[model samples]
Target: MSKRDYYEVLGVAKGASERDIKKAYKKLAMKYHPDRAQGDKSLEEKFREVQEAYEILSDERKRAAYDQYGHAGVDPNRGGGAGAADFGDIFGDVFGDIFGGGRGRQSRARQGSDLRYNLEMSLEEAVRGKEVEIRVPTLVECDTCHGSGAKKGSSPTTCPTCKGNGQVQMRQGFFAVQQTCPTCSGKGKIISDPCNPCRGQGRVEKTKTLSVKVPPGVDTGDRIRLSGEGEAGEQGAPAGDLYVQVHVRDHHIFTRDGNNLYCEVPLGFTTAALGGEIEVPTLDGKVKLKITPETQTGKMFRLRGKGVKSVRSGAVGDLMCKVEIETPVNLSSKQKELLEEFEATCTGQGAKHRPKEKGFFDGVKQFFDDLKS
Candidate 1:
């Protein structure tokens, strides 16, 4: 029986690109696969036919020869025993993901994983910056074997089972299954005389002391990176980095937002009623803030350049001090009498000195009148 055209079997035009042919074959393969269409002989035969069609049409040279002289030109039975080119193309498409059996061997020397250390700092320390010492547990190179995993004079030997391939393949019913070598566990070598210090591993677990310089104006959530301070990799691979994550402690006197500092300053009634200068605390030192006459509670005063300078940029921010007027407590009888006399004199002025209180009373009266109506 004459064979069908390869392109027509795969349902692709002769001028179709390699990608188009692969796409059409993949759809047919998925649809007619024996696993998907169980016990269906017709579908299984269709799957094999599509696979054979793709095997010929997907190759440039074989496709050209077949296009010129038909199937007889490139047939394996025609004295040209299955071409090396055709075998490689089929194997690559089928089993490329199996073990280290691909084109190149996988790299043995892998870098270590990055580590994070939470560091809590006082607000003052975070704002001013300081050198902090942190102890981190990490893997360091073994002193005895110097990261070779071998004894003083001896070294590791190639695995007897896999012969340094680092992988072993097993034939499983029409498919080759590749897995890590059981003897070497994929290392491809075995150490006969292991180091006593690190025991067959090239690294030792120990606490490492690192000095990290915290930059000025670093707020919470800022991280400082210390290069090559993390765990050491196996067989002299490159070490990972150490990240110091900052956490600023709550301050009793101040709260910070970005570069700005905010604080509440309590003032006596006399200082709020009759203007006075009071001392306010800043990161640098104490600064005097002037309060004008009749200063009310919740009044804010800004002192320029008294806040922290940003670490990202050197721009300084202002300190905002909010005033909270303190009423007199523990008053004597004489003080109470004197306050009453002063209140009486103020009442005689008829709400002129207390415009806010007078407006509040006016609103209250209007509300009651509207309710009665």
Candidate 2:
């Protein structure tokens, strides 16, 4: 098929100036835009023709060639056509002001990324709080190049492809895409003579030993931030922060809830039956807990201000101790005889000594009587 003339395709005269050509192209592009056309094959074909015609006429070199020699001068088969018009570029350049976001935004030296380190501590250490030392592998700025990424006494040069904008426009027929400059990797600069220690990245890996002071009562899922302790930035940019994620280990004897601590204390059956004082373990020390007569299992006792302190409110919590009456595991013959005799004394006592047991059977008896009725 015969190709249309570039001037005729854009509805412009042969003597049209660059500004006039650009204005005509913008109007035609908006009208024939694939988004506006909604998959209309004829509009898409017209858009392609408009794109090809504007591509040839928009540049001085291609336009001059086409004006002198027609389609043969700007043919890709003949090693011509350096690509002047792009779909996204038309919107970016012509309709950018109407829709916002057409300006080129360049980046400077890129900052380092933030880092996280999981720190595990014992419950005692988390409750009482202690200073802990940790080793973290991270990137530090190179001393030889002073974070410039260039060799000593030399400096980085601006990227030639992106012109220090750290971005480049790529075109594929009607499609246009903006991407990071491959030459500088979005740093806007290139190091011709990279530092020997850190190569071209401007930072080197090293293990840093840091001391973290844990506040009193920092529980699991708590975080401690260390400012400027993360990886060093590229090309002398500012460093990011390091977060220490705390996980308190489970204790053998104690479980914590919010600002309180809960523990189960085993009480001797004799001590539960007769009132007595027993020493129980606490984070502070052994504390005496008084057991009242007829104390039952699952009975909870509170020790005021003996638990973990609140890191946020500065209030001390109470320690809740649940007593579980322990039955005798191994019994001597004499102990078994004595227990039998003691049971015989309470055999006809009804609810006097065992109120719960008597009440349970009374309810069971009433349930059977109702069934009979």
Candidate 3:
């Protein structure tokens, strides 16, 4: 049968994004997987088709060729029949569960695992980025062996068992099952005399001190990735990355929401009644904010561009200051006398200024009147 168009096989448009193409292939691969379909040969053929579609579409160079020249561009061995596609690595990444190999077959030189470090920062430090030193424990390549498990004078030799394929096949009934070579441990090589420093692992456990540069406006749960700062890989594999997770400490003055900073500013009763300017604290410095006359509690005043700028984008946010009117405590004799005189004047106003208190008393009077009726 003639080969189907790569886009048609994956059921994706020619202009599909990389993410869209991968998503489409994942769906088809899961549906037509041989393990999912038991011993069905038709499903196996469909699975191979989906795999071939993904193999061509996922690669940028291959995708370009396939888009321009169709199958003839990618197939070097054209008209020689469809050889088993390089499904070993691809299947391991996608359907490792069905193959009983989690991350596909592990290479002899595998990249180190990625590491995460939680970094605690003060609100000031988070607002303005700071350089911090942290200690992380990870595997480092042995200096003595130079990443090779062999002794100083000797080198590793190829395994006698399974030759150098790293896998050994076993026949059960009529099906052939492939498993990692027991003797070689899938390395396909054996070290006769191990290095004295790292034993046979070729790496050592050590703690390293690293300096991390935190950008301005980074909030909690934000991550900064440092390349090649993680654990050292075995043999000659590339090192993984280190992720620094930010955890901003709670501040006594301000609470942050995204880029906006919110703060509760306490005001004297006199300031609330007769408007006055008060000094309000901000990340930059203290600024004077004017309170309007007869201002009630919970009134908010916004200071534009006074808050933090976002880390992803440089957009500045506003700082919201909420007024909390504070009542006076510990009155002197003269002050008490003046307050009492002021209370007498307030009583004459008939609760017009205190509408909430007037409403409560009006409700109490109606309840008594209802009882009498």
TM-score for each of the candidates: 0.68, 0.71, 0.70
Clashing pairs in 2: none
Candidate 3: segments with Cα more than 4 A from true spot: 1-106, 363-373
Each model's lDDT comes to: 0.79, 0.81, 0.79
**Clashes (N, CA, C under 3 Å) per candidate:** 0, 0, 0
Please provide, for model 1 over 67-109, each residue's C-alpha lDDT reduced to its tens digit, 9 standing for 90 to 100.
Answer: 7667865674432223555556446534864544554233254
Highest-lDDT candidate: 2
lDDT, candidate 1, at 235: 65
lDDT of 3 by residue, 1-373 (tens): 7999889998989999986886686567657766577999989999778767776787677787677667766763431112235434444444554455553244365567667787878999999999999999999888888878777888778878867666666666544466778988877788899889889677888999999999999976566889988877766466777888676777899988778999999999999999999999999889989899989999999999999998888999899999999999999999999999988888857577778778899999999999999
Task: Identify the runs in model 1 with alpha carbons over 4 angstroms from their true place.
Answer: 1-105, 160-181, 348-351
Better of 2 and 3 by lDDT: 2
RMSD of 1: 21.5
Model 2, 44-96: lDDT tens digits are 99977876677678768889878877776676643244233422443464445
Superposition TM-score, candidate 2 onto the true structure: 0.71
lDDT of 2: 0.81
List residue ranges in candidate 2 displaced over 4 A.
1-101, 170-177, 368-373
Rank by lDDT (best first): 2, 1, 3
